[model samples]
Target: MGNQTSVNRALTLINEGILSGVDSITLEQLAEKLGITSRYLRELFKTYVGASPKQYALYQQLMFAKQLLHQTTMPITEVAFAAGFNSVRRFNEAFAQELKLTPSAIRKQHAAGSMKVQANSINLKLSYRPPFNWAHMRAFYQLRAVDEMEWLGDNSYGRTITLGKVRGYFTAVHNSEQSCFDINIVFTDTDGLLQLKRIVSHIRRLLDLDADLIEVEARLSLLGNALPKINTGVRIPGVWSTFEAGCRAILGQQVSVEQAVKLLKLLTAHYGERVTVGGQEVLFFPSAEAISKAELTELKMPGLRKSALRALAVFVSECPDSDVEQWLKIKGIGPWTVNYVRLRGLSAPDCLLADDLVVKNQVLANISSDPQESELIDIIHAKDKAAIKSYYLEKSQLIGQAISPWGSYLTFQLWSQQ
Candidate 1:
């Protein structure tokens, strides 16, 4: 048991290093980041992940490069450099060796069958392991979507995105036949591969693209017959930026979800940046720098929530290497808010929103046999609320551990319940 735990820890650290240094990371630097020798990192990867660190990184680069080739009209030279290849010849050689096809051939094949979109946009097919519940995903985003920034239609979901100074929009429709999401991204700049990679990564996180649904289902099945069975492939929704998630969490502290969305819309409308994409106006979420410096006296929320928002913005803007502990340091940031940010913003899979009203109510409903659901809910909120909350938190933690690793998904499943 001890050895297995140690291996998991080591792999997690090494994976974090790789993810944080995808564009230009060397094996030695990755090893240093993991506080181990390069040889040990190589052995660990070979033993567990079945690939050397360099091989993994190279594969990622090649895949991203291939996506760019098939999705955009970028020149071969630009694609080569953008994909982090030292030269176009190296890129061409790598493509031939890895994919057994020339870059031009792949592009030509894509052109023959790719979806039509604006000339300035790019389209990529993002695949997921199957059994994904597209209806649940659509409803989840539609319910709490902020105005102007997000859109959820009959069979599609999309949002305007802001990554640093670059702003763009992406619309995605699920291709059930292929078990993939076909996303069209329209951006203002195509400067380098780094930005493109970041945008794709953000989208993957937002849409829960990389989840192994089979494994998640298997783990979650341990909690008896308690989950929302109809939506077995439900995914935990993710925010585009940590700052935006934090602000939304703070805004939602004491209000219902609908009220919180209203406040968020007001905040964004008052402070966010407006950009035009495909002849439509979209507002980007307000930046932390702007929030931290602005006088937000006009916001309709109470003083404490306003203060919390500013403090969160200041912390996120000033401390780039943020953690839950740093977030907890803010005056009004509680465990629920912090965990909400962790789950949705940072895409941490283990954090559960234990203190949320809906979570507590749903958990109580699952555990208790009381037919009077409303009566039980009133008891929870009436007197001895603190004790009841503590009991629910303890039970929820135990249940969460039983589900382990996939607690975020479990939380979403619980949320999906009536």
Candidate 2:
């Protein structure tokens, strides 16, 4: 752990390179990103991560596929390919060997429970990382809480999100007594369950559950006297699907929070496929393909903006294997849309959507304004400003050592505060 920065960067690189999309990298390339010889990177990974770089990459690839299989309706073969497995036969073999269940069986196990499990618990399971600050998350949502459509779940802490079109309700509880988090979301019987796993995955991402907080806290301990009131382990709220998050971002453009929520409601209600479950109305964010097939021209969108939104959806539809980079290129889409999707949809742990008007104004008001870009740029500079800040803090007692592991979490917490 001597080269904390390099090791930490390497870890993020490894995970991102594997999970960022439908591609996986070789050990040699991973070594290059860490600025180390392949042998050295292999040794470093084995020592710190308990697995060689290649093994870790394989684990990530396979596990991601496993999650998708258990959570989605996607064919096992497709999940295998998406997770970078070379062949469905190999994926089935490994999954059966490693997890004691065939990939197909895992999907069957869930599908079998379609009737026995309560409506709320059927589609997903509540996931969490250790040391989650549940109270803080509930409080954060409460402050910016929407009025009618959402309800903060009773006595216990949780937020109720009433989506458009699809009928569903999700309630999250930090089971302090159990030291585990609990989530229950029941959607009207639809194809949405196939996508629910993706939603839960993004939620885990936004909350930064993947963060290694101990390393981050160690870094923040150093900046001691000069730092602003920095908090550790703060999590960002994430949205489930990229398109769903993107649509919300579009609705939020240049409007007040209340107005944006209204627009969100209007858009979902108008374009979404409405459903009723447990006697409540819920909407599912429409897919690009679905939107492309539907008639949105008569909806209340502004003339060109309507087409712009449709174009964005169409762009994503055309590229079924869409990622953030592609979403940013569509007309009327900008840095804000991508970052919003990254934060809410993709659940990127360290992304800060300072590109938004509110966030930009907050940045300028809190820090110096060299330029509008400077405000956004500051967060990305110096191998991650939050990383730098955390490293400086953790290394306060050290002279020139690398504070390797905590930078990602540092970035996550800082962006959450902003």
Candidate 3:
């Protein structure tokens, strides 16, 4: 692994060690997966990834262990084993060896007793690679806010979302929570504590927290300070429930945000389940099953819209276990709608909803009120030939990568200007 190419190959292998799927993969199995001699792979990985494959695996487990320690009511032994260690003793030994502290010690450090869960919420910090403009980002959130479900006020953005059947609320205090963003979660179930870590991870993506800002700056250098100051890589503010996101998307079709929000509130007040918490009326996003069966035709929405919304409801109802993104297959549920839901609802880090007016304008020579699916077809519709082709080529690559890990923020930057 001395040459540049060999170094690249080994680095590729090491980077492939994603945090997911580590629980089931053993060191011996990973060696086979990398197709290198296990010992050599071990030595090279330690030199490159800064840890042996076994150690890396343990590091991943320790991260999971940390998640449990902070997010769950699980016993330390159970947290150890669930993180894939064979026993509590082994987990403690490894925790001490790698982290230089026992699992119990870490748990005590963040204990509910020691740390206050203010306003009935736990504060969490999300890390990011940044050139973030918090002022601009908050302004964007303020513009697109929905009523009751999500709102921007009191110098914070707050909303309630449904995770599967579980309902929870999050409030983002722009500066108070931690490094990039601080969010507090108030949930219905204590079991929800464990789920918060993954939710936090998704929120980071939705916000484009992990984006490589240096690369982003390079790509947008042509836009000069307009983009950097404007926050082209701003993150997508996410929703907890895909159902709520779907409803919001449906309401947003060809309408002003205020109008769309009014319609959404009408729908929720009519169909969404009501919960009483902290003296506020919190409405759960309507489930597919509920939407499918309920009489939401009361909204008097257009027939196409009614059908689309109904289709979304039935889709959500049928596959009760699948994510809302997985269940969105109604005839009118095209790329735009699904992509919107993914961006905001499912917390997809890089989905580009092509139907968005912002995305279209950002990637075009001249702005149209629309940048539809047909725009993608216009490669064949090149009437001006060379000039049009050159124009498209210049902007196309940037457009494609706009949403890769930070598209929502890109969208945020564009919309904030509006």
Give each model a TM-score.
0.83, 0.57, 0.68
lDDT of 1 at 108: 88
Which candidate number maximizes lDDT? Answer: 1
**Candidate 3: clashing pairs of residues:** 207-235, 234-409, 235-409, 403-407
lDDT of each: 0.74, 0.56, 0.61
Cα lDDT for residue 147, model 1? 76
Tens-place lDDT digits, model 2, residues 298-389: 45656555666778778877776455667767788888677777666655444534344444343333433335445334654644767545
Candidate 1 error regions (>4 Å): 1-47, 70-73, 96-102, 105-111, 114-119, 192-194, 225-230, 370-391
- State which candidate, 1 or 3, has the greater lDDT: 1
Worst 10 residues of 2 by lDDT: 399-408
Checking candidate 1 for backbone clashes, the offending pairs are none
The Cα error of candidate 2 at residue 59, in Å, is 5.4
Cα lDDT of model 3 by residue, 1-418, tens digit: 1332233433333323333222345555555644556787777766667777666666766886786688555668656654666677788888888899888887877777333443344666555665666666576567666557666765577777555444677776665334556667777765444344445554554465655767754554544322434544455566655676787888788887878867777777777777865557777666667778876766756778878888777776766535444544576676777778777765554554545776555545322223553553474366656654565555545564643444554555566564
The CA lDDT at 376 in model 3 is 38
